[model samples]
Target: TQRYAITIKRSRSDINDEIKNMTLGCNRSGYYRNRLNLTENSRHRQTSSKLLNCLFKLFASRCNNTWSFEVRNSEHNYQPSKDMSVNRMAAAGSCPHQILSTIHLNDLSLMAISKTIYNELYSIRQERLDSRTPIQALLNELQGSDFEFEYQ
Candidate 1:
């Protein structure tokens, strides 16, 4: 006599819902496993924040239009409303110290990168100041008057 065995497999949507439910349960729990999961989520959040910061810096340097540094659709839903306000104040040249304080340095590695970039910008500003040549003057000299200005 021969016997047949049956196997069961969960659907993709079912698996996804299972994961979402598990994450929600872990978030509510205070066990070590839950803490570890939370730590991993925080790390992911930090990485995303750093990426957004770098992208914003690159875009701000190249594009004329303003870019809002808001993180949407994040796993943890960590928003930086206070940071945005501080950045706005800094842009207006009102609060310098608060601007530095507003930046979130959750990951040490990304924090180092942020510090390095900030130092480089500071050095460039210092050189500009020492040479008594403003950045606008240098840029104007580099690009001749033949370049037409476009108004949107």
Candidate 2:
């Protein structure tokens, strides 16, 4: 029962080249903060975080048409959650054809595939956000214009 979250991602590629690297850490890898400020009063109840500051991590790299995985700080600070298993392959299997078409046949590692899919998805989301929201679109337009405004 191991679950990991991407802690870092790096990619360097031009139209003709691609390289990717990522670090995955135990899902519970951060300090749990019950409150942002002790003095703040909230109508909603404060929720507890599952973070245990776990140190376990896996580094995955793809370079020179090769893929490598390395582990560091290999101890988990908490017990694995029974119902928290994730099916990474299933998720990857559902990647849209547009994203799948950008991947090279040699770059078949789960990390590689996921990186490509996520990058495309992120760009699509950003484009949608920039284009669909009237306020955001207006602000972007204003930023490029000589128009001036004041706020308090």
The lDDT of each candidate is 0.34, 0.57
* Runs with alpha carbons beyond 4 Å of true place in candidate 1: 1-90, 105-132, 135-152
- Where does candidate 1 have its weakest 10-residue lDDT segment? 53-62
Candidate 1 lDDT over residue span 1-152, tens digit each: 21111112111223334311111111111212334556654665553222221111111111233332322212322232221233344446644444445443433222323443355456646665676568666566556767665432
Tens digits of per-residue lDDT for model 2 on 63-144? Answer: 7778899987788766543311123322455455434444434343323234535655665566657656757676777878
Clashing residue pairs in all predictions, respectively, total 0, 0
Clashing pairs in 1: none
- Residue 11 in model 2: lDDT: 48
lDDT, candidate 2, equals 0.57
Q: Give the poorly placed runs of model 2, Cα more than 4 Å off.
A: 1-19, 33-35, 38-43, 83-152
